[model samples]
Target: MVFRTLFSVIVVFDIVSKQIIVIRDKLPYLKAIVQYKGELNKDYPDTYTWAKFLELGKSVEDSVVDNIIKEQKPGQCAVLIYTSGTTANPKGVMLSHDNLTWTTKALLDTIGSDKAEEVTKCTISYLPSTHISGMSSLAAG
Candidate 1:
């Protein structure tokens, strides 16, 4: 329900359903909360409810976080955005950490904001999460 509240679209599948329409349509993989009538399936593959997914964050060890941070580099890919197939088939565009950081800095400079801590900022993101602009906005924030 929390995920549904955050996202406009929710792809629900019945336990006995033969096909998931979104997946069948070749849409990008979406974060989902599967619905079932019987007992919760702990061993279900690639399935997680919003609460269950959030619980995973609580269980992460500090060392794991530290190791992830240590593994990151400026040139490493931060995100991959698939372009809308307006002209041709959709293609994934990889954005590096340096690319995102540079864009964020450029945005701040253009807005005459010296530091993020200098002022309060509020944003209401309406663009789809898959879009480059949307991803950039989230990264900049």
Candidate 2:
């Protein structure tokens, strides 16, 4: 995945290339859109704005959502987090929903917080969202 930073917004690019490899290489990938501008760029066709994503979400039926939720399991992979490439290429760490929930519960217990909502309402988080530590804080709250 290629992430292009524009201001505080990050644009996800399907093809992580320096040039227009989509046309030259005939790569099979979707187009990219600039989220801030809410416009489709010729160079990036696979991207969609946040608004578009929300719109797509709104189109999903409640039954479909319920069905997906029912299919979810604690042992299933919830997220694939990429490690910081300090030595080699960044490696993806697969974390299950159970793992995150367990960590969250442990953190909350350690902090003596019975209600996550209360802590979340007052907490000011400054950690990077990409890191596990940041994820744990967010999940705990």
Per-model TM-score on C-alpha atoms: 0.58, 0.64
Tell me the tens digit of each residue's lDDT in model 1 across 14-50.
5422344324334243445444333344544545555
Q: Candidate 1 overall Cα lDDT vs. reference? A: 0.56
After the best TM-score superposition of candidate 2, give how far the Cα of residue 40 lies from its true spot, in angstroms. Answer: 7.9
Q: Can you give the lDDT of residue 28 in candidate 1? A: 40
Q: For residues 32-117, write the lDDT of model 2, one tens digit per residue.
A: 43353434444344446566756867989999999988998988977765676799977767788888888777878877776776
Model 2: lDDT to the true structure = 0.60
Q: Give the TM-score of candidate 1.
A: 0.58
- Candidate 2 is scored at a TM of 0.64
Which candidate number maximizes lDDT? 2
